[model samples]
Target chain A: MTDPSRLALVPFVSVADMMRLVHHIGLETVLTELAAEIEADFRRWESFDKTPRVASHSDVGVIELMPTSDGSFYGFKYVNGHPKNMKEGLQTVTAFGLLADVSTGYPVLLSEMTILTALRTAATSAMAAKHLAPKNATTLAIIGNGAQSEFQALAFKAVNGITEVRLYDIDRSATEKCARNLAGKGLTVVPCRSAEEAIEGAQIITTCTADKQYATILSDNMVGRGVHINAIGGDCPGKTELARAILDRSDIFVEYPPQTRVEGEIQQLDADHPVKELWQVITGAVPGRADADAITLFDGVGFAIEDFSALRYVHGRLRDSGHFLELDMIADPDEPRDLFGMLMRAG
Target chain B: MTDPSRLALVPFVSVADMMRLVHHIGLETVLTELAAEIEADFRRWESFDKTPRVASHSDVGVIELMPTSDGSFYGFKYVNGHPKNMKEGLQTVTAFGLLADVSTGYPVLLSEMTILTALRTAATSAMAAKHLAPKNATTLAIIGNGAQSEFQALAFKAVNGITEVRLYDIDRSATEKCARNLAGKGLTVVPCRSAEEAIEGAQIITTCTADKQYATILSDNMVGRGVHINAIGGDCPGKTELARAILDRSDIFVEYPPQTRVEGEIQQLDADHPVKELWQVITGAVPGRADADAITLFDGVGFAIEDFSALRYVHGRLRDSGHFLELDMIADPDEPRDLFGMLMRAG
Candidate 1:
């Protein structure tokens, strides 16, 4: 138990705790709720203060801090992307995040965002698909059956009523692993031999292959009209999934232009390329899925507010469940100015 | 005990653990070591990647993220300053930090930085005083005897061999509190009735008052020749301690001019006011303290590398001491790309 008098205790949700929380709430239910929370926050986009993530790049990988605030709460995620880590039995991406009271600037929650980031990223993609995908879209072609594959499959089904999923990865074992995981999830799961087979009869195609270069997972000829392409793999500079001609044919929508221009599939286009903002689309200020034949691409690079929403959702659920631990992260003195005295007395 | 797996488990220095670590090592020794560590990092300033801290300001206070890297290691501190917090029995400034291996992009340590930040700030001030203060200076007048007063008093003794301290605050109880804490510390401790009396014979006037606005704790006429003014409290924008005329009279040195111009005492000076970089002085690339009659001022705003050095020092100490807890912060799976599979199997 932590002392109540001191402000040292912060509630922390570990990865194990996160898995338990998801099961307790039902994974599909969690995804559906997260999508709703993200949509709600997006509607109030004007209220948020956003900035491009602050990154430190090295020869091997990059570490970034993504922060945002909405007058009452402040949140940030500490995430790293090291594509080569997977070779050493380490995750290519790992993350954690914190949410604090804007009034006090004291963290209320510390959470492992590795699992949560995949969840929220999928949630954001599903939320965008709900607005931009064809009205009766049911099949999802998930190209790249890696860490993010199953979540993307589940989230699309939960939020957008996706009933069929075709999977493809360069590694056959990856495709089989994703298929095995989705066996009893009430979806028509297909393990495709190639990318061409994955997109057959699929109105929604999500490409999430883990590559650190500008390799085209989907060329222009593969994409048909009126399909929603959720490109999730190409999220860093020099890393992209779609060819330039495919992006040219699709009506691009983005989370934040300044960020997407540098990181998303839109990086292939000119800086001045006209793309619709996702938040504006959510708020009904702009059109989505225009005229049913224009290929709408949610050039989703992900954003800070989506993570904020996910954290807020998880924090709200912690009280009903007991999967969190108290962390002694802050220093509170009997007399706030007697910091040295606190140390002296501790001695 | 924590489960040791392929996943990296960052050792966390909790507030209680930090207190124990300080007692185990002795606070004076910690201060002395921190000063040396800060000085060593300062000498290699050109090799460091420095940025003006990213700040998020609210009506109540400000929260900042300070990050620095030296090729092999990356470190960042999340800190908040809310003056109104003191009225509610909370420390005005609270902080936490993380250090990660740059090669792997994995956090190696997580620490409660409230105590460490105080230690580093004082060590930095004492480090600056070591070069800028008049040689053989013995007495220090600590204006605003609050949370930082005792540490400032001890750091000077540890780093620069100060033999006496005179304390003053608007609240006489604060002055009494500081003097009581310093009792029998092998130094002469004096509790003064006013700021003027506090600086009577002191050669170093350390102003560390906690005020949110531009209010002078030390006026122009109060300053004397050859005294090194360690102006600390004037850190954030609009909060200053020394009068403008005093800034003009003293030769000022700062950390990161881009940041100092916005947050330090030099904020009141001209946009291009000439000031010596502390790193240059420490590296012997620039001269420090022109002469005995010339007043030299260390306009310390604190820097990221100082916190990085403090964290590095603590990380080195953790291996030798048992005052740390392993945090299950990272999610590691046997299959690096099987995040969802791990969750599914956790059931």
Candidate 2:
């Protein structure tokens, strides 16, 4: 058999390779770069082909396919959310993504997105905080200290100049683990005994719990004036982390209203609730923070465009990083119409 | 860093491995097995979750994700169709697929579906012909001698006892190439100059042209009584292969009504066209071929359940075939909640 052609091979980044690339470029740098890419894409969000994720729900969890295109390139992520997986020693969320050329419809890159989703989620949160949070804010309060807590802390520190992160989880060991992981990450990590203690002096609050129910990690009374709340954990229908009272008191900003209205914290509110699109705020079409005393909430259900931005960022790094394997995923017959001839010759 | 757990490893079958596996199992046996599997799935089609493919269309081509599940396992195929690619020495279609365990939402198998799609499509066509075609049908006329022609011919031979295949393509070289590739195959191959000559004395007429636009590959006058028409090329919107008159004269059977009404030859007909569901025919809910003189047309725009069945078939072969590579595609942290700690440990 002849060697497969260049078009037959797609660069694939494994989990170890992704970790190596992150450590090689420095996680803070990757997060900052991802934020820049996401911000740039968000600034021109109209150029994208956007749709709500296609989801398949089951008794245990949900599997979703999020796809988007920018006319020149197409990308999609296959992600699963199984909260019950953790008890069986499996990550609650696991994902992988692919990027393809729009002209030829051939995949160019495939990568493990479990780690990248963490980084992109954090980067997206921090990027939103840069615009919605109070100017010169330094402290961030993380309501759930699980797999995503440390990445969120580092992303805020790297992208928003955050100097401290207060972590709190129902399980004390989770908070301790988060603090231990962020020991030398150039920020002060505080393991708080309760969510109230964690949000005492924090100007930015991010909630990313793994519960699959409508549990209020933040209530109306606990939140103060002039604070930005990044609600990311309420990413599916029937799952939210913020109380209805808290949402009513805050000015809400969201990524893709059609999706956020069903999956974000805003799902608890009326369908006709007025909320600003984050892209509009980024593009200067809408104001982000109304006043120094006004509360702002970013209801973030992860969108496909963010994943496209992250995959594009990773694709650009492949040339210099050499952190991918070329898999013979596509069949390239020498004579385009002679695929059977190629197979017969191989035999 | 510790080695990735077994949960992180996904079995990936590449193009070469797929070719090798086909040869190892013998093409005829594989096609017969695939036909049986597709037949079994079609019998229980109501048990599967079905949806039309999610497609991203461009001026030049389309890329699609087809997903389905049978409650126990979930599967999806990522496929592309760029008719212009053949002019640039690339296959007009390429595909890959993944099968995941529904309980955990973890991928178990990823395989190159370009060859497998060809096989499954042919198997599907032959399986459909089994119920619709005249008894003892021995000759097949393939109208478009492209990448899928030979597979269709062989599958008909293996599953429907087709002893001769008449091949015709607008480009005569494509027919010559197909004939040369099927030289030593059990069936006799004949090259014809036009579609009219190809269908003469043939019992099963298979149309699989590569045109992205609607073309009258077969007209009403050319198709005779008692012959089963397997139209597989009219797979996308605005890409019908047969003339509208032919569709009006035949009793059409379709995989899925909503999708076929938009993508198959039935697109040129009414929205409420009288067509029998192929699964209903397979399950004996509907009668197939009312009489020997009745004209039966199978409007086959491939469905997700067929791909799901194909992926499941390939996955079952993996236990003894050993023609796959283990890919570290999933991130498996020792503590499910400590993904950041796993990354830090990797560093």
Candidate 3:
């Protein structure tokens, strides 16, 4: 254990501990609660210092830093995506983040965000569906079944009452694994041969494929009218999955517009294309879907605000469960400026 | 303490512990070692993916994110500067940073840098001075005597063999505090009444005023020939201290050109003005001080590379000392994708 004499503590939640929280809370409940927290944060969106994430791209993959702050709290996430990682026995994405107190610039929590990212993405998709999807929506078409597919399925089941799910992926084993892992979850999971077959009659369509380049996973002809699409794969520059015709016909919503214009599905469109921010839709400042026939899309590139919400949620939940580890991320000193002295006294 | 099974550990050094390290290892050794590390990292500069820092300016202060990667390792620092913090009984600057593995994106070290920052800044300045300052230089004029002043005084004495220091600050109490802090340091201390008194006959002039606006602390006429000026205070946009004439007359060196152009003393000059990056000089690619009588300037806006160096130093020093605490910052799992399952197993 760290020195108890320290002035502050940074609670760390490892992957194992995070999964325990998920299992105890249940996947559906965690997603629903996360959505509620996200909605609450969005309702007071004006309080945050918002910006699009900063990204550094390399030939192999992209690494990004997403930071945001309210007057009282600060949060940032370090995340990377390398589609080739799976071939190397690694996940496609890995993330970690910090929640800090603005008053003293001290971190309160540090957490592994790999699993949290999946959960937040699912929760965010479900949150977007609360506004865009039809009230009678009960079925979801999950294209590109992978690590995130099960979480998305469970999130939809919790937030949108989605009871039926059709899964499809280029790799049949991935879809089968997703189905097997999600067994006895009280949902009907149907394996489909292709993306077109998966979206046959579903009201909510989520595409979370792990492709580093542009591949048209969904063309305009295959996507039906009024279907709410959560496009999670097309999240980097020059990497999009949907055809321009589909974006042109849909009502697009984004986390942050300036970022979406550069890195989201909206990158496929012109600069002047109008889109509503999800915060605006969540806060009722803008319309989501005006009619039953309105095709709505949530171009999910992931935002710092969602990570902020996720970090805060995990910090709170760990406290409730009394399962946390103290980290020596910050120094505690009797005299703040005597940093040199602190070291001398360590022994 | 964190979970022992987690592969990555977060080792933190507090201000007091850092001081203890300095006292134990000796200040001279720390500066010498830090300089070597900084120089080593810069030698293979092409390996690093570097970017100008992203800064968020508030009414009272500025917070910034500085990130860099060398394919194998990644590092970033979260720092803030508010001159008014002292009035509120706080340090003028507070910082923390992380070093991570690029391949796995796991943090290996998390450190409190408020004290380390002061050390690294001084080490960097002394490193630059060793190249730029004339041979047989033995005196330094420090123009700011705030919390960082004592560190600067000690670092210069340790790294450069300075035997005398002239201290000056706008606040007399701060100057007195610095004098008291450095009383038994084996150097002659002169408390000066004015900036003119401080610079007289000094081989090196270090300015570290804590103003966030453009305030001239040195004039061209006041600075004599052959003086190596360490410009440490001017780091944010619209916040510069060097007169235009001094810059026009001196041979300037910087940490990162892209960043120094925007936030360093060079921010006041035209974009086309010539300047040498410190790395180029350190690596023998460019000339630093051409002659003994030529005025030299080191525009010191703290860089991520330096923090990376400092993190490496602290991590090495604390290993056997056991002054650090392990944190659950990385999520290591038997099944990487089963983040939720890891937590469940922990329970």
Candidate 4:
């Protein structure tokens, strides 16, 4: 009967809009800025309320809700992981998220997180690497040339001054895809034929392959001393990429232990195994890369706080970018308690 | 960019769309249909994956995520309870929910739940009343005339056999507002000054006041034999409306025991107190309203399954109503692993 209230309109960033935003801001700048936002949130980790993602596991895949709040803003992501989906012309992981004002419980931004998750996951890895990688790391090896490979390459380049990227995947076409995408992106993109060749002369190694069950994309023999490993694919129970021997040799740093122990590559180890918490490292409570001679691993199973930070960052830029649609997502009656009156008036 | 894949566009029902759909199908029929949908889901309660909503409590309010799955479909509602928000010209509760194909982990429908929540809450209470209220009940008393008042009146009239409606509130203007809104809704609407006067000849009393702290809207002596008390507002800890003495006198039936113990009026009762689960009553596993003289109280602290059912109901009608908008909420690259290429192509 009347025009929808402005309070009811939530800003929604679609997948294409997210792409445009990244292009407008420059993906490298977005990555660098996202990493900074993530690092800031990590420094004040004590202020956040964390929980292991609530997952609904089915035979074919799993759908999960990752929610976190930092008093001022609240955010959550709906993500689904189905490794076999790629064969059906579907993504193995698809996501969307909402950022709401904690004070009023009204959604401020709703974004398609399938692209954003890739960006945040890469930024988080790059942030951890900045803390735990060897001094002046220059070259990176990406062992899985899948959906996340290019973003990881760019993030490392943007944040850590990496000059070269070496790529490898079980599927050669995937490696070509990654290599083709990285062409002319201001880095030496080397497409390697084997995982061993991919890691050759690289200081940082990132393994992100999609296989629902345990599969070693990186073995212990290949990982040398002083190299930082950003293991991303080993998220979700029973899905891991690094061999336990590789894990045993590396000084493991994790996002959230409770979640990492169940969903990260560290799920391969004993529950009580000693590992460094990355947030503590960022906050200076714990040492990162104590010595250059030891291998370090950042077991990054994506966390909700990263999504919160990503949403907060997007919400900040949405005002000027105009790359979003206003969604009629909330119910706002002229009188808060007159919802029925509003409904009756609709006729 | 190529046109968004059909799979990427999720149907979103806004508040206006929901009201239009409700009016399209008579409100009474929607209530009756929603009640049946809720009743059917309750009958097969074990089919759903259940968990108490994950809540983030702050100094001012609480934001929660209610998630559930019935094996085939997954649903979750992002709801915030901020009583202070109403004073700021915002709804005390504003919500939106998503229903996804659990098989693929992709969202199919997104609907504004603030209005839908009122519809479903009322339908759920009325459904329980149909099974637990005294036979030939006609008069209904609604205490705390707020956003939910008119829905309760109509739901009871549609689901159960109710004719006359009596309303009362601490603020008499709320009562007047509710009565005025129900003007031609096919019932005798009576606005009373006190809660006591409102329940004068009513067999069913619905108390739904919004208070962050415990306060008695209905005392012990006010409740008598053979009356069913639908306590809907004592949904969060410390926000109750009924006296402890009143809870002690009734056969308390609840949606879920663990949740009710923390959020329902039974929070005032012992942890080990024997209370009937509403699902059990609906499934005939437990008896409801054992006799006319036995007082029955439905401690309805809305649950995830009810939201799941409501989402399912809206999704079923979305195609025919054509009142929903399609938003590109998922990434659909031709090659699932070529997400980076999709972004580059968009540029």
Greater lDDT among 1 and 3 belongs to: 1
Per-residue lDDT of candidate 1, residues A1-347 (tens digit): 23535477999998888888998999999999999999999999999989988888888888988999998999999999999998888998999999999999899999999999999999999999999999989999999999999999999999999999999999999999999989999999999999999999999999998878899899889999878999989988888999999988898999988999999998888899999999999999999888678898988877999999999999999998789989989898888899898888888
* Tens digit per residue, CA lDDT, model 4, B116-159: 99999999999999999999999999998999889999999998
Which segments of model 1 are wrong by more than 4 Å?
A1-6, B1-8
DockQ of 4: 0.89
Residue-wise C-alpha lDDT for candidate 2, range A1-347, written one tens digit per residue: 98999989999999999999999899999999999999999999999999899888888998899999998999999999999999999989999999999999999999999999999999999999999999999999999998899999999999999999999999899999999999988999888999999998999999999999999899889999999999999999989999899999999999999999989999999999999999999999999999988899999999999999999999999988998999999999999988888788787
Q: Rank by lDDT, highest first.
A: 2, 4, 1, 3
Clashing pairs for model 1 are none
The deviation in Å at residue B208 for candidate 3 is 1.8
Candidate 3 overall Cα lDDT vs. reference?
A: 0.81
lDDT of 2 by residue, B180-276 (tens): 9888889899999889999999999999998999899998899999999999999999899998988888999999998899899999998987999
Clashes of each: 0, 0, 18, 0
Q: Please tell me the interface RMSD, in Å, for model 1.
A: 1.1
Give the per-residue lDDT digits (tens) of candidate 4, residues A136-221: 99999999899999999999999999999999998999999999999999999999989999999999999999989989888789
Q: List model 1 lDDT by residue over B1-347, tens digit each.
A: 12437465789999888988999999999999999999999999988888899889999999899999998999999999998898888889999999999888899999999999999999999999999999999999999998889999999998899999999999898898899999988789989998999999899999998888998899999998989999999889988998899999999999899999999999998999899999999999999999999899998888999999999999999988899988888988778999898888877
CAPRI docking class of candidate 4: high
Q: Point out the higher-scoring one by DockQ: 1 or 2.
A: 2
Docking quality of model 1: it rates as medium
lDDT of each: 0.91, 0.94, 0.81, 0.93
The positional error of residue B272 in candidate 1, measured at the CA in angstroms, is 1.1
